[model samples]
Target: MEKYMKNLTYESVLPFSEQVSYLNGQVASKTIAQNEALSLTLFAFDKGEEISTHESEGDALVIALDGTGEVTIDGNKHVLHAGQSIVMPARHPHAVFASERFKMFLIVVFPKKGD
Candidate 1:
């Protein structure tokens, strides 16, 4: 698996939200885990920060951990706050924007054989 945060040990209990930090005018991301079938990432976005619309090869699940944000999927916008979550379907256009400084967990799952 590919790890983003150096020196961070795995299989230990810790706060997921505190693992990544928000930076002014920038989006910060930490890859928790990455493999052929799945990828887990943590993100912190500053107010007004956004990820441009794009398509993914796998389905993406975004869960808000703190503050507010918006996820636009296939031209529709959905507002989200702490404890909220939304799924972006594979090969569909989607984007993420922070209404305020926010933290989130993103899990992307690739299609498996015989599914």
Candidate 2:
């Protein structure tokens, strides 16, 4: 859902984890905000669920919020637990897997024209 807008303001503070819930045997996602330059998304994955390998045009930062997960980038694997984070470079092939029920925040930023 592309409902959240970049310039909107929230009236009250809310917990990010409570915004999305994990579904059994599936992965769930919520888009927190997005614009031409950046996007913010929250994801919840049940045990054994995964996002298949893919490439992105923008750099992405993955922040683990709960449980544990495995992130494979360019054929290398990294295990991440709560409070850990990793960056996936633009155009690199990457994938995400949940070792256990997990939640994470993903921030992706689009590169400007030229360098």
Candidate 3:
């Protein structure tokens, strides 16, 4: 068997909630394959939504695909407009809030470790 030719969409994934932090009615999807080193995800939030404070064990990158909002990371708040993104380092306190309806693509990188 071979890899590298698979396609994915949000509906193809399962739904899970995390207390780590997120706005009400938030939804997400992630894509992964065997031995995949990184995970790709899409997140959607309704207006006035937010993601609670939390830290990731792996590095995370978030790209805003639409809408506007403010993100507070490590006590700093920054505005995010369409086509903007931010990388949150591992173990850093971070959270997100949507001033309006919002959507984003997330990439979480996981380096392979020697057995």
TM-score of each: 0.87, 0.89, 0.70
Give the clash count for model 2.
0
Model 2 per-residue lDDT tens digits across residues 66-95:
999999999999999999999999999999
Q: Who is ahead in TM-score, 1 or 2?
A: 2
C-alpha lDDT values of all predictions: 0.91, 0.91, 0.69
Off by over 4 Å in 1: 1-8, 113-115
Per-model clash counts, in order, read 0, 0, 4
Number of the top TM-score candidate: 2
Candidate 2: the clashing residue pairs are: none
Ranking by TM-score: 2, 1, 3
What TM-score quantifies how close candidate 1 is to the native fold? 0.87
Give the per-residue lDDT digits (tens) of candidate 3, residues 1-115: 5554233434445332221223566644434332346666666777877788998766788888777867788989988887898988878899988888777777777656651
State the number of backbone clashes in model 1: 0
RMSD of each: 3.0, 3.4, 6.7
